[model samples]
Target: MYITMEPGSELAWELYAGIDEAGRGPIVGPLIIAGVVISGKCMNKLSTLGVKDSKQLTKAQREKLIDVIYESARYIIIAEIPPHLIDAYNINMLEEDTIAYLVSRIVAVNSHLKLKEISIDAVGSSKQLAQKIREVVPKSVRVVIEEKADRKYVAVSAASIVAKVWRDRRIDALKTIYGNFGSGYPTDPNTRRWIHDMYSLDPYNPPPIIRRTWGTLKTLAPLWYKKKRQTVAGREKTQKTLADFLPKI
Candidate 1:
């Protein structure tokens, strides 16, 4: 992808890449991460499209932008992590690693582009996490990770839309198989009600789609598993006590 730096002497990069994510909180669908890369030439077109944070836009607005991004961006990359991968690696760490890898892959593909800087809508926005991302990315390329970067940078905003669009579609697919649970957020009444119904029916084994490790499910454990845990604890304590060892002397 033959790219050149902006005409001005002050600019340093032939390409700019932005990274953002979606579905970090939803319980039912894969977490989607997206990166959008554009030349300085395409930046104005993106701005004119009025890109902003994905949450602020309607579903229709985001869908429209997705097409615009694909047409305008020099390169785009997406990563999706399912429940099993999320369960294996922590969500936050997984997000961090995924973002780092995405940027690296973009740079690798467009080596001639000479990326000036990478903009990221950081998942948790911590210094240590930012450092970890920097560690994996090429040192020649600068990385600027900020909270709410999607709202501030057009590239990041486009990535946010791409990620959200993919997540929404995946959720729709899940709905067909699992039935609608209203966005799959814990705060959603439909999701909560569904959890209650399913847990009551089979406390020992909830649906595999449910993230059993999440605190939302753990909070409900008192309803069924608490008593069994208590009984096991009581037995262990009694067996370890000096009085039990004395044997009715």
Candidate 2:
């Protein structure tokens, strides 16, 4: 990759990368993380496309821009975290680790690209998240973590669009099998109603797509919450019994 630095500039950034996520708060779909890298020269084209934060755009508008983003990006990386993983782990840590994974992967695969900076839309403490990323990325690379970075950086905004588009398609595919759940947000009445109805039929076992650990389930169906607790206790007891049988080392 051709690399250049402005005269007397300390930063010789040749390619800019941005990272953003979608479906972080949704109760139904997978969390989508996307990272986009574009040469400094191509960034003007991205800005000209009129891309903004994905939340500010309509579905049709995002769909229209997805291809353009793909065309303009030097590299686009995406990852999907399933609902079960979200339920089993701390979401904030999961996001942080995933961001590090994406950044490391991008750098490893495109070692030739003179990538210098990465801007991420913050999910938790910006300082902590940057620390996690810095541990894996090259010392020369600069990590920028900011609240609402998607709104401020065109690169982050493009990443947000890519992640959002992927998540929307995944949700649509799920709806074909599970029926419309209306955004899979706890605050969405349609989503709550669907959960209520599903739990009414089978309180002990939620649909595989839904997050079993969500507080919304406990509120809508106490029976489901009770059963989940009981199941967890059973697993713990079984593990203890197995430990007892094992010879102490």
Q: What TM-score would candidate 2 get against the native?
A: 0.84
- Report RMSD (Å) for each prediction in the order shown: 12.5, 8.4
lDDT of 2 at 94: 69
lDDT for residue 68 in candidate 2, whole number 0-100: 83
lDDT of 2 by residue, 1-249 (tens): 111112211133488889999998877879899988877766777788878899999999999998888777778888788887666556776687677777777677556668878899998767777887887788888788999999988889999999999999999999999888999998999999988888888888877788767777778977654222323522332223222332222
Residue-wise lDDT of candidate 1 within 1-249, one digit each (tens)?
111222221134367789898988866667888888877767777889877889999999989888877877778878877765555554665677667666667777677666777899867546756787676667887788888999888889988998899889888887788777788887888888877877777788766566655667667543432221122422333233222222121
- TM-score for each prediction? 0.78, 0.84
Scored by CA lDDT, what does every candidate get?
0.71, 0.77
The 10 consecutive residues of candidate 1 with the worst lDDT sum are: 1-10
- Cα lDDT for residue 144, candidate 2: 87
| Cand. 1 Cα-lDDT | 0.71
Give the RMSD in angstroms, all C-alphas superposed, for model 2. Answer: 8.4
> Which residue pairs in candidate 1 have backbone atoms (N, alpha carbon, C) closer than 3 angstroms, thus clashing?
none
